[model samples]
Target: MTAGEPDLVGPEILDGHLYDYPAYYDLVFGSDCAAETAFFEDCFRQLARRPVERIFEPACGTGRLLYRLSRRGYSVSGNDLNPHAVAYCNARFERAGWDPPAVLGDMADFRLRRKVDAAFNTINSFRHLDNENAARSHLGCVAAALARGGLYLLGLHLTPTRGPRDMGESWTARRGHLGIVSNLQSISIDRRRRVEKFAMSFDVYTPTRHRRIEGILEYRTYTLEQIRRSVESVPSLEWIETFDFAYDISRPVVVGNLTEDVVLVLRKR
Candidate 1:
């Protein structure tokens, strides 16, 4: 353990990093690993004009994607606000010695002396910036850190329509196992703020036990139109493209390229 790393993986709760290792990424991604990797790799191949020699992954939780990309010959540099996540990624990369320092800092104001060929925030992490100013600051920072004509890719979920909040729920019971209720939900937008209040709650069962561990996640959403206004305001940034699902298509529907999330590829204009 490093100076500030937490001791446990699941239920051991790190101060800033996510608890429940191996499971965190799995749950968030839910069996979409290979597809997601291929998506990111394809983006890199196109935007950087080659497989990027050195790349940056901000909010690189657990370093799963970083490790995968590094193995493919890309030098991976990463940073996250969570100390526990940084420590865990460091340990995993130490064996291969490919791990650069994954720093702990504010994503909005991070600085690196060495520039990267490409920079990315994968898996909808950009939406977590919380507000327009933070998002703009982050965009500016990314533009500044890239070498000339470097690529920037961001994959994030589109803001849900703030009209009707649809909530659905389901439960499952296994043999001799505890019953659990999974939450499926949505929230309407706050039209004034161009944000939505998303709410979700889940109840989990212990192994073969019936006690439910419940939690909730709330989010503020940004619609495509809203995001467009913000992206267009930055002088050094250009929104080259957006992919909701597939990166390969001729005259793909740009506006509708959004479902669960949107993937936007940008360049320093």
Candidate 2:
């Protein structure tokens, strides 16, 4: 069976934790791995002051990007708060006959034995640090883990100043005999508290088995000004440029009140 393909068994419904199933998570999110990896390399080439030979990823679920980067000849390491993700990543590395560096660690406060050339945490994972203190600490930690002049690519969606506050999206992906249909919707949006509660559900189908998984998650919402202030709190890192989800290094954008998706390029001072 391929990765993420469930065994040929009976039908079942599970109220499962989303992050606990790394393979299925990869199936949903890993399709753009090559594009994202290329984007990272381009960012390093265009924006980084130092050669990005060794890179790190925080909140690297399943090491999907890490594995791809390693294959591309860059030294890669990452950490995740989920033990299952850590184990899954390490297992993949071991299968490839490479040393595994994914470890169970918190993104807000974790240390690396050696500094890296560049690091990244994308796709709004940084918003998981639900408080100002934790967000500041995560920035400080990433700054400390980089050499001088190193770059950190942080990507997230900013809270919109206008329009509908509630939002959602759905995705469908298939690998081999496994098919997954996933939906993510905001159940609650509290502007005053800077929080958004999300309801996520996945319907999986195999040849002989069908499973439905559900999970709820929360992310801290940040306006453009709020994120700017948070970045300013860490003096060692300077925000250099802002890009949108397109991941195009050639086009840097000015984040205005209307902008939502943003990728901030920070350089260690």
Candidate 3:
């Protein structure tokens, strides 16, 4: 770990499960690994004008996509603000006998010496930017780092029109002998300011013992229109199209009462 980067990966119950441990985080979401990677590959094939020999993943938590990209023979590089995530990714690559290019860096100011053919931020990770300016800066930096006419795939939920609503969901996954339950809830949403507050509770179960760790998170919400406007504000990026989580590019984006999330295909101008 670097000087200021955190070395802890969990067991600090109050700090939250995800912030503390990479293994629990992976177990909770790794079930969808195949689907997520397939979506990324599909987008690259459908949109990129040039072959995607290299990819850059910003806010790449746990290197899920990065690992998959490498497995498919694409050169992969990524960065995460969380030092734990960066360290975990590096270790993961090492275990697989592959060199890892993940590092600790802020998305707003991250830069690489070599430009990549494409970049992506998956699973609502981009919403971590709390405001429009921050979001724009992140996009601008990504655009500046990508090759000319290269593609950028961004995925996140679109704010609903029915005003702020509370929602909750839960799912279970296993890691070896341990079983984990991930419970997520939306505590509040500020429609006017486009911010949503949420919480996560992780329950870990062993045969004889059980533990719970919880944490809160906040995200800046974006509607479809706001997303288009934000991209417009980033001079080097052009909005190409939007697809829902299904990753079906043939169908046009339906931004309506029920639309909640989308993956936007953007090009570096």
Candidate 4:
């Protein structure tokens, strides 16, 4: 799908990331699919009661993880609210001669006819729930879809209880003659509500045109206690363990010590 024309300001431009530019989603962020998928596979083997065969991904944009996991011989299915991204993912799978299972569905209220052995919401995608109610609903939906002893691998950076912290990160990716540089920034932090607002700007360079696409990306930040509460509310899921981005299952989560990113491994009861 073609991207919308650039608009630097206003709520209209605050659409979710990749809403307007689904074509660049995989090119810009899916380069590490192999390593990330390996890490997830490790968690599944370590935490799941039975061998994992069926996998599901919520908010599986660009289907990078879905594609990689499928290639590795798992029954992979995914859902994203963005119809365009979902369309692109389905097309990609069909082009590869596989049946497409990706669909347009909201995380807060999605269900499948078949249960999965494991499910995931990686790279801060869980944060997109944006509020307590929505977060609970999404968790409930995921829990309802898991088989007994199934696993849920969730990855995100917890919001610190300490004073404010501002960070920025940028990366560049090129495809043939087209190059795109993306800058991600945390624009607001609401400690009272445990929410953070983000802004992502992408500069696209092509032979005929150069443009910027940017928007607000909000997250419902979770402290350790907050995450515990959220998970506990869904009795079907038991908090199994927490690991830093390094994906070490043996490492313990120290309350006062944490890296910028964490992976929470939960098991179905």
Write down the TM-score of every candidate.
Answer: 0.75, 0.93, 0.89, 0.88
Tens-place lDDT per residue, model 3, 155-229, is 888886666533867888986677777888998889798888889888776655566688788989887678779
Candidate 1, 1-269: lDDT as tens digits: 22122324433223322233333433434334466567767766666644467788877777777777778777788888776777777887897876455777766788778888788775667777878899888888888877767778777666545443334334332223322344445545565765544444333344532222333344546677877877887778788877765544232345542344567788775
- Give the poorly placed runs of model 2, Cα more than 4 Å off: 1-11
Determine which window of 10 residues in candidate 1 has minimal summed lDDT.
10-19
Q: Which is better, 2 or 3, measured by lDDT?
A: 2
lDDT of 4 at 138: 90
- Candidates in order have lDDT scores of 0.63, 0.88, 0.81, 0.81
C-alpha lDDT of candidate 4 relative to the true structure: 0.81
Which 10-residue window in model 4 sums to the lowest lDDT?
1-10
Off by more than 4 A, model 3:
1-14, 162-166, 250-252
TM-score of 2: 0.93
lDDT of 2 by residue, 133-249 (tens): 999999999999999989999999898787754488888889989988889998998989999999988878776667878878899999988999999999999999988878777
